[model samples]
Target chain A: MNAPQRIVVDPVTRIEGHLRIEAETDASGKITRASSAGTMVRGIEIILRGRDPRDAWAFAQRICGVCTLVHGMASIRSVEDALHRAIPSYSIPRNAEIIRNLMIGAQYVHDHVMHFYHLHALDWVDVVSALKADPKATSSLAQSISNYSKSSPGYFADVQKKVKTFVEQGQLGIFANAYWGHPAYKLPPEANLMAVAHYLEALAWQRDVVKLHAIFGGKNPHPNFVVGGTPSAISVHSSSGAAKARGGQDGTAVNMVGLQTVQTVIKQMKDFVDQVYIPDLLAIASFYKDWGAIGSSGGNYLSFGDMPEKDIWTPDSFLIPRGVILDGDISKVHPINMDDDNEIQEFVSHAWYKYKDGDDKGLHPWKGETEFNYTGPKPPYEQLDVDQKYSWLKSPRWKGKPMEVGPLARALIMYATGNKQMKELVDYTLKTLDVPVAALFSTLGRTAARGLESKVIADAMQGMFDSLIANIKAGDVKTFNEQYWDPASWPKSMKGVGLMEAPRGGLSHWMVIEDGRIDNYQAIVPSTWNAGPRDTAGNSGPYEASLQHNHVLHDPKQPLEILRTIHSYDPCLACAVHVTDPEGEELIQVKVK
Target chain B: MSLEDIRVVVDAGESSPYQADALSGNAPVLLRELAEHVRQLMAAGEPTAIDLNALPLTPADLDWLKATLGEGEISVTLHSDGESTLAETACPGVWWVTHHNESGHVVSRFIEVAFVPELVKAHPEDVKTGLEYLESLIFDLS
Candidate 1:
């Protein structure tokens, strides 16, 4: 019998941050085992020590450019949670709550659209093949799928020309390094062209849609998030006359123009998702239906829950309820307690870092430590020493078990807990593809769930906006509560966890405040939960576990199948480790020694 | 004063006639230039690149530009030796391209009016070597 061979994909592209995957496969090309490693040490937690808790959001938001606002939201929520603990009488206003929901909802929609088209679509799409498609046929095919306004033959012809020019010029720019014409690619030429066209559409669509965040939170990337409430003030009266007198600078308020722009952006989001994103996903999923069996991570799912109804502290008020589903059993959901020391813990046994107590012992985020321990081989070496410390990411465990997080977990939990909308969406998608409920547990299912949830969140944004407008009509225009902004009002010693369902998955920022300054701050981000290394119990993380089973590699050099599985998780190594080397070199150094 | 009179005063403050007209004026002249560039690309298939850094753009002007041009079909981030991003505007042929240094700072920004940005194209030299490498691999495997 032939020995198993190893295939390594260093610096996995299209995702938010740096990641490397090493898989050992039999001669038959089926993966037997896999190791997921976050190659960079993010020492943001270490740098955060002794800083004012109020300013932590600004620093923490810089963790990842892709998931910019989520970290800021989590950071501010952590400070607010601590403040609320200090002042039990403190509460965020309804207006503030509504605005935060809009911001979060916008992030989910924007991130999901960007992820599907810009990042993950190429894994399925063949850009070179799109050039071969008949523009008229592509237009007809696009129109047959949805009522998207951009489905003119002339429009498609222009897009085809643009793509053709790129191909003829022998420059595939972003389309470079693609596994074009690979056996795994199954989309018809016309379908590929339609997807390619929408892929271009989504890029433009996202820029406009994200302006909602800028209107409400100041800027798109790493928007301003105040601890008590949003930074935006609702302007009931026009500052136009005043602005003109002081030179045409727009006022810092949610005026009629701002409100209308938000409305326009929301409509645009709905139109694009309904017309372009969802249809493109379904169309693409139809082609890659076989991927439904590829990447299943034991069906254990976890969600910290996000988008609160009344207060963030109250778990029952969450839009996506917090719970745990173990072993793919949807009938029963175990309640998640973020405060319990036994509920959530990070293990560094398989990771490079060492804990204060022991390398094998798991520590809760409240007592989490970020100690850099590079015990692996030096740079420019080959395969990782997987038997020892491999990744920079600490293995995070819920109840001593590795669980998958993100859209799949959220969708499964929502479906199991009898969320009507989620059930309808999942049922419709599965029925359309003629796949079973079990199919929702694989890589394609994970990607599909992301698309489905974007629609759910985008539709929900209207309700949130309406509620905000209703509040304004009732003369409740206040956006910030200044009661807890002062440091003197905070408790001398306090620790609190700010939990939210970021676009990727469940994210939490745990902070210990001493004299109103952060003593020890640790952020257990979503990507860490999904992409961390194996735990003390030797349980592989979601990324590693998902790559197991029948993920067969046709070509070891291309490794397109591996990319499909990893990109489905939308790995964001930037959120896990906040530090990059001075040279900003490749995170994964693949050596074949 | 009557309650109706008080309501009227408040309404007057909130709604300004000049403000409504001035909002339209906020649109930048670059939008016209960008449109012309797109027309050029469509007619002649000749790529036109505009350096946005050279243009005097205020924050308001930038916002207007974003709104006016809108985002088009594709946005790409290329990480070779350094990071560069190219995004197409709603105008099919117009594109926004930015080059970043190693530290993730934008060194130069351009609005390239073409079917696709030049930076996204594969270098001819690299393609030549890539083809050779592929042929060699095929030969070795066979």
Candidate 2:
């Protein structure tokens, strides 16, 4: 027996934020144990204390640059819930509901597309080798796969030229610093070129699509949103008399032009998902079918449902129902209770935080605390002191177990709960990949589930837009309910939980409002659930446990295998622990006593 | 009859001809220039950098330029001193680089048609220092 070797990948790239993964491998290079750590401490929750409850959205929205609007939406929902509890008559109009759904749908589509092409594609596609592909052959291969519009010999030739120029200049830009030509890269040169082309196309597509957010919410990253409803009001007047005579349907403020742009964006999203993203995912998955055997975390999954069809409070109206699936069972889904402290709790034993009672105890988000207690070795250390507090992220456990959250969790829960759409998508994808249902528990399955969910959401956006337009045409243009706007009509104290399914996974924000000011705020973001450290029982979190058992690294230096596993979770540590130190200096100054 | 008595009918909120003309500015000449620059770069591998801050551009014009040029394969974020983001337009080599100050305000914006924007490149001195540090570490370990 050989001594176990330890490998560390600090600052894992291509995903949203900062994350570090340390793994110990046995003699044959199979990973035996692993630990995940979030290196930064996000004190946004602490900053939210004593602030105006209405302004919580603005501050929480800044938590993550990638999942920008999700936090804001969750924050507002939390405040809105608290207010609604005070005044039961408060409710958003149908138009507002439809628009919110549209925005959420757009976010899912845009985020999922970006993740597949920009973040996750490079894991499978080899860029350098694409330069060697024959443009004619690449076009033929693309056509054979899907009848996408850009699959032409001339188009591919142009893409190849651009790649060659980038290579010759010795500046791959975003493609730089990648483990290109690695043994883990399984796509053929032609497939690689095709994916690279779509990748560029998606970049352009996303810029246009994000204009939907801008048109409706005033900006793309961290868009404006009011507590009662969206900030966008239907335009009722225009410079042209004829346009105005047409009842302002063709004017600004989410009018004809805006709706048309949204429609175009939706079509583009659907077309790309169907033609480029799905085909690319299947082709890439086919090449790496053996990966189906690796990267399964603790077999429990959790999802907080999102995109309410009628009312946000009604779980039955949720498009993606909330439930927990245990032991990889597709037969039963246990119901999740957000209000139950015993059901959802966060522990800080393996994290760099302390609890008032004890580190071993788990506290619910409503009662969660963000007390920093960094006990790890100082900066420039080789590895973390894993036996003690290693990560800034608290261990978020569902029913005292380190449950995995994200697309896999959402898909499995949906499938187990008999969601016809999800079941069909999952079954078709498994059939196409020629992998078993058990493959859904692996890393490739997680990646494929993201693409599938994007398709499902993209297709659903059309219905949301139609309903929103119907409401607008029927002269129902109420975008905000101002009854709850004034804080004077509030109770002395109230607590509420705002939960939503972010593109990465389930996201929830808990807030306690007292006299119209935020008493306490805690956000259990998707990354915190997936990229958290160990629990009080010393059980590894999703990122750690997923990397355990039989992940054989070809080269520990590159560690592309480890990255493939970690990136499958789409780790966004920025949302988990975001703090900016402006002086280009380290904020922590620990004195060894 | 006085001029006031002989009133001409006009639409409400409608501007005078001169005011309307003033509002309707010239065509986006800079967008034309940008497109031409991109074409030149694609045809002959030559690089061009246009400083957007120096140009007389309205928000509408900027939106037009972005929509026309489209986005490309790569977007990068640099977090040092302040934050800067560089994204390529659909026109392969055309890149848009925006630098934000500490207060999260846009300080500089540039559109460069090149293999990659220069600001995104690692400093040569820093690279040398990194190599030296790695060597020192190896020596100490040995």
Candidate 3:
């Protein structure tokens, strides 16, 4: 007797957040259908009701532990928009913008490094495979780029021995319970060993970079990054420790200047991006060129775009231009005004609630509604088709079309707008990485571009930081808010929108208020744009539509093909998070069908 | 019988399992509605996302579904037999159906929750509210 097909991967570890994927095959064992289930409901939206508008940023960052900074940005901007605070600056002061840029850049460094080694690597490089790796070859690869080559079994070689010992001791808790001997473990054992070494090194650096966030804002996981202005200001004199000194504490050290701590880290990361990361991606890409086609949903691209002026938070001097790329061709490129430019709505026919048609219009976050219904009853789209009703996320649209938002989108938007530095960097990176310029147009290109862009931003921030230090030495340090503008100072009747290029992708916060209490506050987070469910017009989310065309090359057991495509979206599920509804009341009492 | 001792009756045979129609009705619209409602409520001053894994026993929530149905049959692919008190007096189908009903309720209310047995077995402390779920799984209405 043929056993029926059954596959369940619960508690997907490593990626930050709770999501379970349940995919099943029919009688013949093909993935005819699948559903990605989000687990955990803290009722964050429910908790935010009626809170003071200015305090919304502090509360919103609590939504996810990973993308807390983006949440903070969205939350702060939402209030800023609601209050109609025309953030002052022709160009945010050079020192202020540089300070802001370096802080945000530090966050990307934390995210990308953690992502490359921790989340996606173990899928291909087995924990068990490390025990079999040739230690000398692994050591050589690390030493080649590290510039600290030692004939004696050095740091990397020692790290490898420790890992092998653990693996031999059945202590695979590092990547415990993973599919160790899967067919996708194709890299030479030494590469796997080298990657494992970097994995540990990256984790430490990830932790070390938080001081950057703490110095500027409060802390990270979610840094307290202000949108219109930063919480911390610029200064040269260091009687008080503004931020932890980079590698040393005393002023005598070459790299231990105040903001320069972040500057140096950014520099280190920039070198890694330019010299190590880009080349590493190319080498990895060489082995996996087939991945280029797995996640091409062919949706138009968009970027709310970012401005990195002297005032980095305000929407003034843009690093990239705004608008849409329809069907891979440049279409209508217009200034982004959420009011005249955007239309958003929610559809429940395919969801769990009972509503008359058109009952739920798209309301920004503050004015939005979140009512609880606990019924493991019908699928949301039971009224519609099952094919359409799988995800809990309501699809978000830019001008009612599936538009991809990420580095690739941001880079292309920058190029289309003719920003000289962004354009030049894009070309330079393509040549430096030896990737065709056109490759910068795809998903892998987007992933690689994010790292490269990080380099560009890092380089720019370093320049800004240097100038800021010079200004401070010249006794021109500016921090702290001016006269505390009571809520009355904000234009109550007016409405506004704010945009940012968050780590996950493009982010926007829109607000409208009546008498200053936040009559409406809506934020389109990166994940909302990336993992968006189907929209009202039945358009699939960029990731959703793209998944349909991917070819799962290996057995379903080794889902590298799937994970590769999905992770390329660089999805920060933690950025927007996911929510699944509860079953309704029938379970309380017995019922006869 | 006390609601706790009352046995559930599930339909038998090789047919498709008894449908939890009540559970099904809310799946699609409730989450988005809850997202909206909590959003509006936050505006109007309520901040709560529907807990997908936590079912309500409050009168307003399940009271209607329970009042209308009183008791309905459901079929579930079995995991294991319940406790002695469960198996001693209740039909296996009855026990399974009752647990399924309550499980579905809990599943509906939670915005996001984990109840898969294997996953629970792995990290049960973080996810399993075996105690919270016990009341519904048992047929007592005290």
In terms of lDDT, which candidate is stronger, 1 or 3?
1
Q: Tell me the TM-score of model 2.
A: 0.79
Interface RMSD of 3: 35.3
Candidates 1 onward: DockQ, in order: 0.06, 0.02, 0.01
Q: Give the range where candidate 2 chain A is weakest over 10 consecutive residues by summed lDDT.
A: A578-587
Order the numbered candidates by lDDT, best leading: 1, 2, 3
* Residue clash pairs of candidate 2: A42-A577, A42-A578, B70-B90, B71-B89, B71-B90, B72-B89
Residue-wise lDDT of candidate 1 within A227-327, one digit each (tens)?
88888877644334443332333445366556767777888898888988999899889988888888998878999888988889887887898999999
Model 3 spans with C-alpha error above 4 angstroms = A1-9, A22-37, A84-95, A142-153, A225-228, A233-257, A310-316, A330-335, A341-390, A418-443, A578-593, B1-142
How big a share of the true inter-chain contacts is recovered in candidate 2? 0.00
True-contact fraction in model 3 equals: 0.00
By lDDT, the best candidate is 1
TM-score of chain B of 3: 0.22
Summing lDDT over every window of 10 consecutive residues in candidate 3 chain A, give the lowest-scoring window: A242-251
lDDT of 3 by residue, A1-593 (tens): 22344455545666656544444555444443444434334545444444456666776677667655766766665655444345342223355555656666676666766666777666556666766777777667656645422312466568777976776787666567667787766767766776776677667666657767766775666666553456664422233222122122222222234344555465667665655555555555555554444466564787776645633234456554556666766434555555543444333323323232242344333234433322332432122123544344445665666677877777677677776777787777566556665555455666666666666565665665666555655555554344323566655464555567776777765555555554545556676676665555666666655555444435656555556555666665544542322222433553312
